[model samples]
Target: MTVTTSPLLAVRALTVRYGAAQALRDVTFDLAPNSALAVLGPNGAGKSTLARALSGLVPPVAGSFALDGRDLTGQSPDTIRRAGLVHLPEGRGVFPTLTVMENLRMATACDRRGRAAAVDRAFEIFPVLRERQRQAAGTLSGGEQQMLSLARALMVDPRLVIADELSLGLAPRMVDVVFESLRRARAAGVAVIMIEQFASRALDFADRCLVLQRGRIAWSGDADRAGPELLRRYLGEATAA
Candidate 1:
């Protein structure tokens, strides 16, 4: 008999409350290595809150989280990142004053290996960053900045990457570029948990999906099996022709 390795990351009965309002209630999920898990939900459905908790940006009110069997329930964001879990936040937090190359270098500096190798990997995924190496990150278009955010995260060589609203505020073509980059990340053995508002596109790239509603998981299943009804229930909208 063969025993499967435990999941790359696990959330057991995780709950987070902001002040008096509960943002998540006993939420649970696991991400296997090299797999992509998409979190789908309508606005105010606790998707962002959940991503925050997973990335150690916000504390959990109850329950536990672990990465590779190591406890991370109350760890700081820096500590979690040092442990190979990286979060590319919703706002594409690139340094405005720094050049694109500078932003990538900053992230690569933190890697265990010398910065040279990490820089190479980042450039390989985003050659455009190399082309625009001297441009200030703030000057780049929305899509370019988003790419920089992802490239920065990859510089860390993370085992798990949590991306919040990866497709937010971009042209459809740019969204495709971002998703393609994410696919490459997944191919390279990184587990990705993405919180996305675009259900159709998220499902396109995700192998498994979890739908959150009112701070709870409404549905969790294979993306292929998750159809219009599941999306409707999560989004609270009827399907359109």
Candidate 2:
């Protein structure tokens, strides 16, 4: 039983809606520093919606989130991102027209004191990027593009990384590499909130698991304890349908 201490982010009674349909309903959770929590559920489970709201891309209909006692409600995406809360959206958000090195150089909004070292760190994490630094981003393989995305996020020196569907549509080996990078983020004492489609992998990497179904929390607890049977209980109905 690993108790999360000194929560870095707290979401309470959060709600979101898309005109007539509700996407999230009174969702609440806390993420402590140096911890990882995985969000798992079937399609249309409001996982992406939650990520969007957290990143300040979408406004919440109700509820609030705080980071280190500061309210983040209704902040702009750039504001939230600059505050050391980085959001890596589902798609690899690399600059397709730019070269690998250029893409890394573009995200210079955060602490510029260590920009050079951060670029070096990014290259170290994904050696392929260093090899293809001069290559156009769009020409790289899917896995390589994903690596660039992760590397871009790291350039910010974020305190919390909200990664949504990081391994989606990637080759199996690339998925492993992407996850290993996220594991490194955790190892560096950064909090992570991962929304992943692969339940097994997410569960294994997370310290806690949260299952969302129909815009609400269905289950949440220790990740290691959430076995197949438990996952099936929440996801089975949708899978069988």
Candidate 3:
């Protein structure tokens, strides 16, 4: 069945496990179309696992996922991506040996309008990419690679972009640049689900926040309502102790 509502993505009673270790337990949430949600948690909070489950990279042990009301629980990654649910995994997985242009081309290959238009769109977002078109992806700086990874995902014209740790290991200014680009994507009507370690910065770009603790939702509310005290509580002594 398909869901016809404001939510573009919905997960119900989701569970993920690695052997006997449960990474996510009864996780659930809704991402409204064109909105941004920041999934916040400390290390081992199951944030990445949840992102993977939603993106069809890791199969859920239980529960259901729907995109625009269409059930997507068991779909392959490619299939889910084709349906406009794109996942940009953590670590910015660009083909290091390939040139910037080649990486963009590889990503655009899956686009319906084909590579040409997708390349154009990618360059429009990060003009620096055009300048480094011939540079091997491995040679690009960490920030540049992050831009390329995001551009690659945008090439698919996804309605929902699931970004896992887009700001990992980047300088502060570069983090601003990446998040700014994400704001642009959201302005263009793309819903975004971001996993971020920096709570304040994540709140800057997110309308709502979900804090995961030990594979379950510890808190969920408007970003404005999620203050330091709440964050400290959810994060526990690991962050505040």
Please write out the lDDT profile of model 2 over residues 1-241, one tens digit for every residue.
Answer: 9974767999999999999899999999998888899898888999999999999999999999988778999999998987889999989899999999999988764556777898898887677889999999999988788878888987787888989998889999989888988987877678899998788888889999999999999999999988888888887744322
Task: Give the range of the ten consecutive residues with the poorest summed lDDT in model 1.
Answer: 232-241
Residues 1-241 of candidate 1 have per-residue lDDT tens digits of 9989789888999999999999999998888888889898777989889888988989998999899989999899999998889988888779989999889888866554678888888889888888999999999988889889988887887999888987788888888888888887887778899887677778878889998889999899998888887677667663200
**Local distance difference test, each candidate:** 0.86, 0.88, 0.88
| lDDT score, candidate 1, position 209 | 92
Writing each residue's lDDT as its tens digit, candidate 3 over 148-196 gives 9988888888999988988889998888888987887887789999888
Clashing pairs in model 1, backbone N/Cα/C closer than 3 A: none
What TM-score does model 1 achieve against the real structure?
A: 0.94
User: Worst 10-residue stretch by lDDT in candidate 3?
Assistant: 232-241
Question: What is candidate 3's TM-score against the reference?
Answer: 0.93
**Can you list the residue pairs that collide in candidate 3?**
2-69, 3-69, 237-241
